[model samples]
Target: MLAPSQAHILVIDDTPEAIRPLLLALRGRHWRVSVATDARQGQQRAQLLAPDLILLDVRMPGMDGFALCRLLQASPRTRDIPVLFLTSAGAADERLEGLSQGGVDYIMKTCEPAELLARVQIHLQLARRRAAAVDDTPAPPLSPDEVVLRAAMRLIGQQLAELPPLEAIAARVGTHDKKLSAIFRRHLGMTVFAWVREERLRRGRELLADPLLSMQEIAGSVGFRSACNFTTAFRERMGVTPSQYRKGLQDGAAGKGTPAG
Candidate 1:
């Protein structure tokens, strides 16, 4: 359980000047504070810190707070942290969206410093209580299959460019190759290698949407050693070369009077 003074809060806001008052108020309470200026950085910080509370800006560049909140909910590590939406606009629809996206509270940036502090304290207390209850009645441990699946998936995602051999991956996740293959087939409807291939193509497709990345860079990123191999695989699965798919995307965007990039 987090004491009032021991609370660690993360403030995710792109506009530092606008959030200065909130920062000062939070600091004055003797609660530890961390800041992340963008949604990507905020997500990384949230997972790393697992702070007592999160004060997330509703609007951010690239991914908005709502999208970031959804990501947090998807992760097992940061899902329990309380998220308070910080906004200057205070629109009704925005508030509803924030709440629907799993925020615990919505606070106006223009609110009184004392009021903000009070709200922060309330949420922190609630988080502490929840933690205490969970401690009293602990959650069940993850099953072996679930643990292996999560670990293998995370490892593959982090090392797409140089994934280990199938036996090596299974060994790392504390299972043999045959058992791992069976697990993948049971849960993912495919063998481990097939899943990895699909994952690589999926990642490649996402990179293809970025106009700045060359085909070679995208190929290297998603585990293909050369652009030729990537193009062949992509064409076999997608019925078009990666370049053609990208051109289609650009063309579609151009037809709608929008820049593809």
Candidate 2:
């Protein structure tokens, strides 16, 4: 049996073609792996399996990546799991959006497989260290910056589905809207709206992986009012519609034969 500290990772992506190499690479390293194609199921798996880490894709049909990240961060059961976003969006602005949405790190889809694996290892190590510190320092308080960031992250994560306007988030964080925008730009390197859109796309991808939910239902659950709107946004960010993404996931699963339950 693999050691627990070897770390189990759940890869959540609507693009099965992109995920295949990542799955093979992590398994080769002797890390147990679980795959979820959509955000809702991914969230369910994270709660049930409590994987040590989550490898998340930023775009999908329904909830998108950022929304899923927020849900994970808000839920006590899964909040501590480290999330690393795997995305095709490699611009500096996109990277900042991913980080601001609660990702520990972001990996571009164009990254070499070896580099991706190395980054995963680094994130797992850091996660373990942070967990240890929390265990050892039971009474320690967060620094001012840490406190502010955590609070902001928590609110953002919870609201990713409903996604409040920038002014609302700024008010909650006890800052002027302009100051909040500047803070996100300065520290996270992206505008607040861009970060929110990235996160929504992330959660939508996760939701698209579920077979039980209809496209319309998934869209509504993830804050989209209509399937047309969801599909358009998904394609804009991910370069495919929800139906195509779902088909790819099904095809990949069929090719893999039976997966471990």
Candidate 3:
């Protein structure tokens, strides 16, 4: 297995100026970086090197990033490599198409070098961890509907203190509330209310694990009207009080490190 720091990174972009900074960014981090000026050569390089990750641009001469992504997915040699699209396209549908075609994530071209490097490192670590755990198991690409659902879920996660109404979230994701409802029911077998409540409790549990936050603060953060309401909802989902759960986790972690007798 290639070490994450030494992993090969292939950048496929038609423009020389766009490629320069990206090359500088990854090579500076001690990664082995390769460049292809067009999608055809990029595809060839991808097959020959079987790179650890790919940074693809959307616009190229013959095959754009979206088309090349399909080709990559079709080939066993490059199917599992993570691809992050770097393009100026910011439309929701464009993002949905990119995710549907098997790209790991989409990034804007104008983003700072630091942000790009951080995203690259993060995905590389995740891919390495996944490869170590699984036997090159291919992940099913998300459908356009699933992409929208994910966008909605992300909005909810970000605004837990005051979640927008379902209508607002649907609008943000470029769908109607009724359509979002049907999509959720079809894919998740749950209504929006159920998903939201579960997400709140889930976040509450994570916040409780942090010793610095008070119960009242965690409660307000997760959208509960009061600490009592938060505790009641938490107990219902976790089958224990939040306080008990926190202490149990700390105790378990402490015991987990003790040497065997």
Candidate 4:
């Protein structure tokens, strides 16, 4: 497990106010956090600090989130750092775009503070687990299949936000749709569409934990066409409505509060 104090977070966003609340929220959780206002600076900081995780904004004046994600993934020095997209665009297409660009996750600006913290914790946990596995390997070699899978996964993650038809992805991979689907099922243990939905929900859950974003914003950010649809899907996957889930988390936190006396 990654200790809260040892966990380093790099937050990339252009808005100063947006950065403040996020920093404050993470600080409250005892996380060591770094802030960067643009992709260029963020990249530089990432090289220097090698943060455990990166929270990148989707839209910017130049060199947007997608470009930055590709750059990071291409660099041998920084490819291992997990990236999560923080953006105002929540359309299915937009979410898919972020994922396909090599981001580990996506988050809407309308997320609750607490929910945001929980996601940070979860990703950090995953990163630590992955790091442990790497440490155990003396000189692990990448297989050709892994290379292909990584490429395909990157494409899938980036394009999901657009909700591209299955055929398009298959075409990009130079394979038939049915064949690609079978490959996904064999390797990832799920259909391509199912993987897309799962990725969307995973991002949605992270957004739901943040108090800063509204339910509607979260809905849009995670690719649901409307709040109603988002809520329904969320309920289906999580066994609770978005509002209810947030309430439950709040209630749990309250229950764990130290006594005032």
For this target, which candidate reaches the highest TM-score against the unseen true structure? Answer: 1
TM-score quality measure for candidate 3: 0.51
How far is each candidate from the true structure, as Cα RMSD in Å?
A: 14.7, 20.9, 10.1, 15.5
lDDT of each: 0.83, 0.76, 0.83, 0.76
TM-score of each: 0.54, 0.53, 0.51, 0.52
In Å, residue 92's CA in model 3 sits off its true spot by 2.1
Which is better, 2 or 4, measured by TM-score?
2
Sort order, TM-score high to low: 1, 2, 4, 3
TM-score of 1: 0.54
What would you estimate as the lDDT of candidate 2?
0.76
After superposing candidate 1 on the true structure, give the runs of residues whose Cα lies further than 4 Å from its correct spot: 135-261
Backbone clash count for every predicted candidate, in the order shown:
0, 21, 0, 29
lDDT of 2 by residue, 141-248 (tens): 333333335546567766765777877676554445787777678767888777766777787788878888898887877777888988999998889998999999
For candidate 3, lDDT tens digit of each residue in 188-232? 899987998999999998898899999999999989989999989
Query: Which 10 successive residues of model 2 have the least lDDT summed?
Result: 137-146
